[model samples]
Target: MRRLLVLGAGTAGTMVVNRLRPRLPRDEWEITIVDQSEVHHYQPGYLFVPFGTYEPEEIVKPRRRLIKDGVRQLTGVIEEVVTDAHLVRLADGTELPYDQLVIATGTHPNPDETPGLAEPEAKQRGVHSFYTLEDAVALRDAMERFDGGRLVVNLIDLPIKCPVAPLEFAFLAEAWLRERGLRERTEVTYVTPLDGAFTKPLAARELGGMFDERGIALQPDFMLERVDLDEQQLVSYDEREVPFDLLVTVPLNMGAAYVARSGLGDELNHVKVDKHTFLADGHDDIFAIGDAANLPTSKAGSVAHFAVDVFVDNVLRHVEGLPMQERFDGHANCFIESGDGKAMLLDFNYETEPLLGSFPLPEIGPLKLLGESEANHLGKLAFRWIYWHLLLPGRPLPLATSMSMVGKRRPPAPSGNGSSTSPRDLQEVSL
Candidate 1:
């Protein structure tokens, strides 16, 4: 019997197992998934935890419960991946050999990467990040007691999970403070290394507008150098300083340590993968998806869902000795909460920037893009249910694996002077 080994039981890994569970012949193939923990976290929900919108228990589930009935589940710390020999070593001194390997071990917050960022005093007194369940819970407690002061949301580095989350926190906090009648006393500031609110130009423009609307200060192009917990200040490399009563930071994100120990990952410990195929660049039998794969896209849940669609087909082709298809196009779609119980949706891929229009359909879209609407907010809320039922179960949705350019309106080409024609001049393009 052939052996297929999947590492990590996070969103990406679990979905891969479920997608392949029924496809592989049970009589001739053995599928096993390995992870250090037995719990699966709905990471997206972490964004809502600090705002008291979601409880910790609501976002966590036993990893074993999500695995397919026939698949084997192993829980232990991974020592290393012996890629040449196609074997995985557990810290407990057990080694499992595999005919094919899938690396879905996701990322973790690396606060220690920044000097003095992880000091015990900093953690206890002022510094807190919402990238983890514990961090989110602690942040909730901190925000609850905060009467009036500077609340700074810092993005320590780029490529963090869910790029929009920091902005979401800022928007939500603004609303939270208003509810407590403390909006006038609490000052909200968003600090980032990027020049704008988001990486994409169009979305950044809209997000910047939202920041203005919510009265949230934007500190752009500020690279974090160190944290002076004693002074309650964040100092950037450029010598700019932002003081805060409470610091909610989004620390650096790095892939699983085992990937680094095995020499199978890049400087960030993210596995080098083909953006279109999710396959390891120079390795034939190994594949990577989700946050672990170093793809040039947002490290978000929806991206993983799209990647899995392309990966499953390639995996099946590999088993049958057929040529693999390069169908993935860096597709990623996300809903941005703009506060006031309204949200906006943005859909784009490698070559296309997010455009203003409707999504899933052209003019008949149930959700609008780049425009705040109550329906988008409902879509965001409904996703929690979709994630638990439709998404994780490996069920197919009407959306395509690759991003569809249909129903989008791109901005007009720049007219030499750095300005473009009217929005109407930009025709809607379809994929």
Candidate 2:
């Protein structure tokens, strides 16, 4: 039997297994997925946990239960992938040889990469994060105790799981404070290393306006040096200091270290994959998906879902020694939650940044793109159910695999302010 091994059982790996199980004949192929944890998390729900919108139980489920029949699920730590030998070494000294390998081991928050972040001193002084289930639960309690003062949402580094998550937290925190009569007393500030509110200028400008309207301050270009927990401040590398009453931080997001140990990664340790094909460089039988691949697009669940569709077809063709025709364009869409029961939708791809318009259907969308609407907010809220019921099951959604131009509008010429020069290097972080 041909061995098909998948690393990491997160969004990408699980979907890949589900999509491929039905196609590969049982007599010829044996599929296996490995993950360190049995519990699968709906990471998007982390944004709402602190605001009292979702309980911890709502976003979690057993990984083993999610896998379809005929696919094997392994639980253990991944130590290294010896590609030359076509072997994967688990922490327990077990070696599994694979005919085909899929690296879906996604990126993770590394707070220890930063100075004073994981230290006991920082924990005592109110520096917290909501990246994991435990972190989110801790932050929920902190948010409840936090009555007023400078509530700073900070990003230690970018390429985070959901790029807009920090922004979403700020908006939801603002709304939460307002509902409890603490908005006037609390000052919400967003600190990021980026130059603007977001990577896409059009969306950035619109989001920036929303931030201003909600009275949240945007402190850009903040290179986090260390959290002065004792001082209740975030000190930048350049010596700039931003004081905070409570710090909710997004730590440096790095790809799985095992990928680097196997010499299959870039500077960020993500697998060096063909941007259009997700095929791991120099390996015909290997591929990387989701945040594991160094795709020049958003590191989002949406990207994994859309890219997996094309990848599924390509995988079949590849096993048959047929050249792959289906190519994955860097398509990503995200819903930006704004305070006051409103949200904004952003849709874009490799050649196009998110433009202000309607989505799915041109001019007829109940959900406006790059513009705020209540329907967009509801759409965001409704995604939690769909993520588990449809997306994880590998069911098809009607959205275009590549970005559609039907409803989008080209930006009018820059108003002497050089708006057209917006940075395209920024990766959208969607969930």
For TM-score, the strongest prediction is: 2
lDDT of 1 at 338: 74
| Per-candidate clash tally | 2, 0
Off by over 4 Å in 1: 361-365, 412-431
Model 2, range 1-431, lDDT digits (tens) per residue? 99999999999999999999999999999999999998999999988888778999999998878889999999999999999999999999999999989999999999999887999767568898888888888889987888899989998877887788888888888888999999889888999998879988787888888889989999998999998877899999999999988899999999999999999998889999998889999999899999999998888999899899889999988988999999988999899898788998888988789998788743445468888889899889989988998899888776778888877886676675444354542333210
Which pairs clash inside model 1? 406-430, 406-431
Q: Give the local distance difference test score of model 1.
A: 0.87
In order of appearance, the predictions have TM-scores of 0.94, 0.95
Q: Candidate 2, which segments miss by more than 4 Å at Cα?
A: 361-366, 414-431
User: Candidate 2, TM-score vs. the true structure?
Assistant: 0.95
| Candidate 1 lDDT for residue 224 | 90
The residue-by-residue lDDT of candidate 1 on 1-431, one tens digit each, is: 99999999988999999999899989989999999898988988898898888999999998888888999999998999998888999999999999889999888899999977788787666799899999999999888888988989889887888888888888878888898899999899999999889888888887888889889999988999999887889899989999988899999999988898988899999999888888798888899899999999989999999999888988999877899975788888888887779888989888898889878744436578888998998888888888888899898766778887677887666566443234543453210
